[model samples]
Target chain A: MKKGTMTLTALLACVTLAGSALAFGLGDAIGGAAKVWEKKDAVVKAGKAIRKGTQDLTPSEEHFIGRSVAATILARYKRLNDPKRTDYVNRVGLYLTRFSDRPETFGGYHFLLLDAPNEVNAFAAPGGFIFVTSGLLAKVKSEEELAAVLAHEIAHVTLRHGLEAIKSSNLTSAFTIIGTEAVKEYSGSQLASLTEAFSGSIDDIVNKMVMSGYSQSQEFDADAEAMAIAFRAGYDPAGLTGFLTSLRDAAKGAPDTGFFKTHPPAGERLTKATSVAKQKKLTGAAAPARDKRFGGYKL
Target chain B: MNKSFWTVCGALLATAAVAWAASTVTVSVKQTSVRSDRQFFAPTVATAKYQDKLAVSGQKGDWYEVTVNGKKGYVHASAVGGGAGKKEGSSIFDDDSKEPGKEDVALAGKGFNPQVEKEYKSKNPKLDFAAVDAMEKITVSDAALATFASQGNLSPKGGN
Candidate 1:
């Protein structure tokens, strides 16, 4: 009777150990497999979804955003607060706007001449607003050069640069709203100051928010667009290079301030523009003289 | 156990962490007082034109270059104290960070006045803001020197 009892105990112990080993091993293996599979599935699904969404943005959507942003910019620059010279600006701006790829009516581009004559500058806001400062005009030699500058700004708009800038940034909703509101609410001086100080040491933050400029690729693209527009409108492509070179030379003497610091060096810009003109096979076309309609305003 | 856990944790944080943003540099006016007392060496009658050159670049004294008419001349360093390179408040704009709408241009008027509107009108009081709006229509050639070689306005012989 004692021998039978001992044998029974040993058999039970062996059975318990084997059962536990099988259960733990199988359970862990299955769990680990499931976790990895889930991660892989998620990644594939996410990538496909992203591809689908990008495909959804049609060219019309691009144009729609482009027009709204441009109109808001033009309205802001109008400084409707100053009514005395509005017609003169409006007429010239309207003429230029008429020449753009998108007519001014599609969110017509307007020009604003700031009263500061000593400080020279101009810009093209996305959509169709072009701003030229009296200060900047004082520096220009003629209508064609002026037109070349305007055409460059116009290309930035037609190419949807501003909207593209916003879309590419990884901004939080709050900052984005602030930027949008700032664009609409800030007056020119405010905008100017905001932009002026943007180039300070905190470069890392500014690049993320405003995207200070187009990619080297975008700059090239805009140059092509500007040249095409100018060439078609009877303006010479070489004028763009000449204007860029002259600005480069003048920059040496001008107070080391503002736009020149932000823009590409004059030499690099001229080289690229000239190369493009050559590639397009455009030759010896003459642009207008500085003294014609534009000569009277020089200091 | 310890090494694997730390490695996994690091990978998770790295994947989840937010990316960095772009930044700008702040260039301030070095002082509140313009260096007005400074003097220029005028060999003869102190001509106002040619002043940007006379202000020796590294001189410790404050030298102001003033433009009268089309000519640029040097000013009494003391009178210039209100304006030249004085340290104003620090402001920032982006240099080269890759985000969107990042091109913020800070326009500093003749002085550091924050309001470009008032500054605009004050500078050109003769023309109302609207008439001056036509100024944007002016070309670089219209304002600066032009290469008239392309345009018929200058005979090939007459242009510089």
Candidate 2:
């Protein structure tokens, strides 16, 4: 109860401070301040929304945040050294991005193969720093299936799922710090606070990507978008269904650990994804060439 | 006071609002290519960076057709935000949204940039950023990508 009032007070303060920034419009007053003030009532509501953490981070910011998360994940896992496999995975991942809504990310999309031969999962750090484990790669039986998995990871990135994991309080504090006008450089105190918030944000995202997993709804959304992207990219939508079917079989009686532990039951995911495929009429046949390449790149 | 006068006033305000919604856009990405065409594989005509405001003359799909330094090109909509702000490289501000606080990272270069990363890295030496750098280095060239697509019998036309 005490925390609730404190939050409200802090939020009100955020609104107040944000309003003051409008006075000078932060050194670059290209947009008319007069026009801005004319809609002060609406602006305040927007400020309230921002103060409540309903804000979007720029692509550059997401890139920086993603790098740290990628670094953290790297600290926990080892990268695969097979240049052939790594190059092959990157080629597939990058090709998929050209067909995603957010094809062009601030730092561009990069795919890293993690040498987790026993861990069947993938991680899409905010921007496009995506990591796919070797065990998961072993599960894929075709180029279309591989594309299906990558399309899902790319969907996660394009959807900004990791940022959704950031705590709103941390975002509010960061907004307060950077949304100031005389902010050429972070003062020592400001830097400390901002760093603390930034560090916390990273922790939040990494926790979601690792250890625990995104909510079931998030997973389903990714699956839906993945199928859409796969269909648009000229791959058989059955690729997603096939991949999900494989997981459902592999996960039967599997211990509640690793991928199976963090994600929804593959059975449930497959059901919903198949339904979506039917609705979208997502029909296509795997090209013989694609199957051949998949056989060649088989790890 | 009269109906025609009120109509004229309303028309002017509506025109102003439309102009305001699509005038100036600030760069949101660290850097984005202003391409000859609205596709990633298109040739880059100009380069814009974080906080650099560009004139958003028009929009094509998700790509914003912008002119910076009189050179016309296209920037992805995700690479920019805000409106009605003139930027000469150094200026960074957001007055685009009628709602205050719509743009949070205009001070991004000063915000969570490399400097912050350096600080964070120093504090967290246990993190393996070297591996991250190695992962980042795994890039696909246009030639390699084209070949991969061709070999796979895939023809990716692009998306949102």
Candidate 3:
């Protein structure tokens, strides 16, 4: 009897995941397959499925969630507001995004320089809202490193990493109402329910972004993706390795918030990046035009 | 059958076959660039707006070769929602094939959009959307970005 119930639970779980039908990359579903998100009160949930949990949210919905997350982050960290620097970063970041796995997002990619010079953190909200801290800018020795950093965050967005942070239970509520009918507007109760789910979605993401770090595997995945994206965009993969090497020493006096607190560099991550860097041929002239332009921007 | 009658039938069938072979796709995103090349940053040949029907052919990975208003170009498959005779294959990324009258209802401003943002903002006054608005304005033109990449010797690989 217990075996039959177990089989029944697995069947229903598969049915729920199949209902999501994400469009971009199906392979992600496999990696995320173990991530079967159950209803908040669902007692019989297990495994690690990725995009399926948040599959009900449209690209536009993802954008709104990201926009709010950006709002929250911007509220905490003010913009530096130097057009030249901001424009430069945007160009570089946007250019790298073209080479990332998922390039064209609903709202497209946008990058901003946060004013916190002491916090060496960067963030990539869903739907391509990227934030780079002045402190992170100060840390990079060259434009390649900057590209590497941006590429890492782009990987997060391209991989829908932020969306993955939405707790499955929250998704259960959001998915329950979306697309069930072709109504132009949700009824008041439905809207309220969705809004609560929306509010919780942001809470889950903000908590992950501000308090805890991504799973070490996710960080590693981002690092590996950063190398591929940077190399494709003609920046050397070494940039990531160089930055990771520097990050190892940063944990000593790391601040309470931002990259250091959330992303404590692991030795294994750096070693993996270093090996990958060695395999990728240095793609472009690093010193002359690139680093020279890097000098033009003020941290 | 007589030769002339047979010839007429062949002509009609040929024309029907041509029409049947032709596939159609509708742009599903707010906008998608029809590029000279399949590369995302390749030069934009044209822009397809939401619900714009396109004559399409060939598929290289996720991009569809499309002809828009006498111009030939390629659009990423994700940019278009449905193919000819394909109705059931829709994903969250797609808001495909709505009824004609209902098209306007789901048009660019549907789902969690500006209205939701406004509502959410009224409730949470401390969140700085004004900053996000200002941040969204930060943009680089294609010409400027191309120049930035070429000048810096950075944008060398995949981008056109």
Q: Which residue runs of candidate 2 sit more than 4 Å off their true CA positions? A: A1-51, B1-22, B68-71, B82-95, B98-105, B157-160
Clashing pairs in 3: A32-A49, A32-A50, A34-A47, A34-A48, A34-A49, A35-A47, A35-A48, A35-A49
Per-candidate interface DockQ score: 0.02, 0.29, 0.17
The positional error of residue A73 in candidate 2, measured at the CA in angstroms, is 0.5
CAPRI grade, predicted model 1: incorrect
Query: What does candidate 1's lDDT look like per residue over B84-159, in tens digits?
Result: 1111111111112111111111111211122423433344344334433343343322112222223434222100
Q: Is 2 or 3 the stronger prediction by TM-score? A: 2
Q: Per-residue alpha-carbon lDDT of model 1 for A51-113, expressed as tens digits? A: 111112222222233333333333333433444343434433443432444332122355666
Docking category of candidate 3: incorrect
Best model number under DockQ = 2
Cα lDDT of model 2 by residue, A3-34, tens digit: 66866665565445434443223322324686
* Local accuracy of candidate 3 as per-residue lDDT tens digits, A160-200: 77888999887776655553424546677877776777788
TM-scores vs. true structure, each candidate: 0.41, 0.79, 0.77
Clashes of each: 85, 2, 8
Model 3, span B87-135: residue lDDT tens = 1123223322221111222333444556666767777899999999888
Ranking of all predicted structures according to lDDT, beginning with the best and ending with the worst: 2, 3, 1
The DockQ assigned to candidate 2 is: 0.29
What TM value does model 3 have?
0.77
